[model samples]
Target chain A: MIRVVLLGAGNVAQHLYTALCNQTSVEVIQCYNRKGSKLHPDQKKELVTNTLTELVDADIYILAISDDAIEEVSSNLPFTNRLVVHTSGSVPMDTIHSSNRKGVFYPLQTFSKDKTVDFSTIPFCLEAENEKDYNLLKELGVTLSQKLYKISSQQRNALHVSAVFVNNFTNHLFSIGNDICSDNDIPFEILHPLIRETADKIATMNPDNAQTGPAIRNDHKTINRHIKFLSDTTQKELYQTLTKAIQSKYGKKL
Target chain B: MIRVVLLGAGNVAQHLYTALCNQTSVEVIQCYNRKGSKLHPDQKKELVTNTLTELVDADIYILAISDDAIEEVSSNLPFTNRLVVHTSGSVPMDTIHSSNRKGVFYPLQTFSKDKTVDFSTIPFCLEAENEKDYNLLKELGVTLSQKLYKISSQQRNALHVSAVFVNNFTNHLFSIGNDICSDNDIPFEILHPLIRETADKIATMNPDNAQTGPAIRNDHKTINRHIKFLSDTTQKELYQTLTKAIQSKYGKKL
Candidate 1:
């Protein structure tokens, strides 16, 4: 069985702690956070330490802190040649350089404290300093997730940028949709099915191939009408920029 | 039974044809395409004609052609006081100037020819010239869709802008994500579940409330690292613009 110490009790930390506690082959021996943070029920009996001195010796130390705090916590932790890993997508694996065996156990999915994560389906991107550490990290990842990907720090960083595009920027568009609906006295739910269907189509088709719009057809009349309909300056600018991008990509004029 | 003449053979026309055919109350009296395009298999036996003179008498006429073509086709149609309508989100209801009983029968969802639409769940945005025509259009919309919204031409145009943001622009972000994944040798499919989950969250939570990312957390270190990771000029520009937008929204730099 792999014994692990989890640091930080934020969203990612709570999620990983719960998953580890549920797994038969892994045991979360300790969970650490800044002072005053409560521990999960499962870790009530396990050491829930706030002090840096309480950092326990374990086979694996998983740092689930924020990107900025990773270095601060890593430097403070007592290193014992134990494998130290951080669950960050953008932070390089070397951030936890205090350990002899360092790696990343980054789950490429968002987590909320209330939401249950299906780790078996979540893709875990694993990176390590050496082959032995890589294999161990891969094994730990596979134990938690059915899909494990071996990616370098640089590649993972690219994936992180892409994640922002798909997740963060996409959400902003949805916000724009919601704003439009509210402004027009139309219930935002009217567009829910379309939003869901759009996402579903990409599962089987490439986004470039799945694209359909006035810009794709070079329908400038409708494009102009849409631009006129948008009253917000920021939204209008976004529409113009995206429409131009689409036009250039498809060799069409907007 | 409602006798209907469909006046186009494009994506919207094909989808509407199938949807109308599936309804027991609606009978397609004739199908008209300006170019006399090959009819879909289910529409084969239905009278297919290129000339408007061949059009049979019907209770309603649905012009599901392009926005620019709507006026030209509607002007040429042999209207016999039939409830004439055009299925376009951006086109004004008065585009079909041939009939005083003109209205819009816009299905407010993206329609691909091959993609089967769930008519029962799709929202039909209806607009008409008068109360009597509005009632007729509402009844027809109810037969095909569970949700019938009485929206004005102006409101429909606003919704269309919102649709562009949520659907077209969102899909482009997905394309960027896929490009980044392929460039890094990571399977784009790995991001599918996360993308779906993000959209799913918005169904229950507001997009602003559901937003989570480096920008949301004001993690400039990770954002800077991501900016460096994106090599393409367009992608770098997109990253900067989106990061700035998010930061501006949250009143913090990232």
Candidate 2:
């Protein structure tokens, strides 16, 4: 069995604690949080540690902490030469400090509070300093998910940026749609089906070919109408900018 | 059974034809395409009419045509004072010629070619000149889908603009994400689960509370790193603009 000492008590940490507990071949030996108050309440009191020195010996030390705290925490770890990994997409594997066998166990999925994510489909992007560590991470990852990518720091960084675009920014666009609906006294639920379909299309089709609407079609009449319809200055500017971006994407000249 | 003459041969028209054909209480008596070559091949040759004058008498003449053509087609219709509607999100109902009882039967969802949409969940926004025409349109709408809203021409116009943001603009963002993945030699599919979950989250939660990432978190370090990582000038500019927009949205200072 692979034993793990989970670090941090944030969303990712709580989720990791639950997922690891369910794995027949894995045991979350301990969960460490700087503030003991933040640790999962369901975890056994004995298995919760407030100080780094009290962390039990484990096969993997999973640092499910914030990006800024990664360096300090890894450097402060009581043990060295063990596989230490962080669940960060942007932070590099090397950020875990040279005192330990640094690696990354980034789950490329958004972890929202109170939401139960399907770990089976969440792609776990793994990186390590050696073959044994890599295989060990993979073995642990496989217990939680089917997708495990051996990504480097550089590639994972790119993926994180891409993710920000697709997930974070896309949600922002949905917010804009919500705002537009509210301003016009329309229900936001009206756009739910369209939102779902937009995401569904990309699963099978190339987005380039899947793209539709006035911006891609260069329907200036409709585009101008939409621009005039939007009352907010920022939203109008965003509309124009994204319209231009889409037009340019499809090779349409200004 | 309600008899209908369907006009135009675009994505919307084709999808409507298939959907209406499946409804036991509706009969799409004729499919008219100004250019005969655009007509659906599966439609019976007898039911396909290129010339508007050859359009047979029906309870409703559905113009699922381009926005620009809605005016001319409705004006030249061989009949008068009948329920004539165009399935366009942007086009106002009155744009249809006064010679016919004007209405709008806008299905507020992106209709892609060969993508069999689940008509049950698609919101059909209906508007007409009179209560009788409105009821007739709703009858037809309900035959195909459960969602039917008596939205005004103005409200429908607003919904159309909002659809552009949520559906069209959101798809472009997906395209951007795909490009980033391609540039980094990362398979775009790696981002699919994240994309699905992002859309899924908003179905249950408000987009405002659903928003997450470096920009919303005001993590300038990761945001700056992402901007630097993007090689394309336009992509970088888009990244900066969207980042600023998100910060501004959540009341964060510049």
TM-score of 2: 0.97
Off by over 4 Å in 1: A36-38, A252-254, B42-46, B252-254
Interface RMSD of each: 1.1, 0.8
Which pairs of residues collide in model 1?
A: none
Winning model by TM-score: 2
Q: lDDT tens string, model 1, A1-254?
A: 88888888788888888788888888888888876365576456447878878777888889898888888788777665778899998888887766557889999888877888888889898998889888888777877888888889888888888899999989988988998999989889888988998899998888998888888777887888788777777777778878877777668322
Docking class of 2: high
lDDT of each: 0.83, 0.88
Query: For candidate 2, lDDT tens digit of each residue in B1-254?
Result: 99998998888888888888889999888888977643556777888878988988999999999889889888998888999999988888889999889988889888878778778999989999889999999999999889888888888888888888888888888999999888889999999999999998888999999988898888988988998898887788888888888888887432
Highest DockQ scorer: 2
Give candidate 2 misplaced runs (Cα > 4 Å).
Answer: A37-40, A252-254, B37-42, B252-254
C-alpha positional error of residue B203 in candidate 2 after TM-score superposition, expressed in Å: 1.0
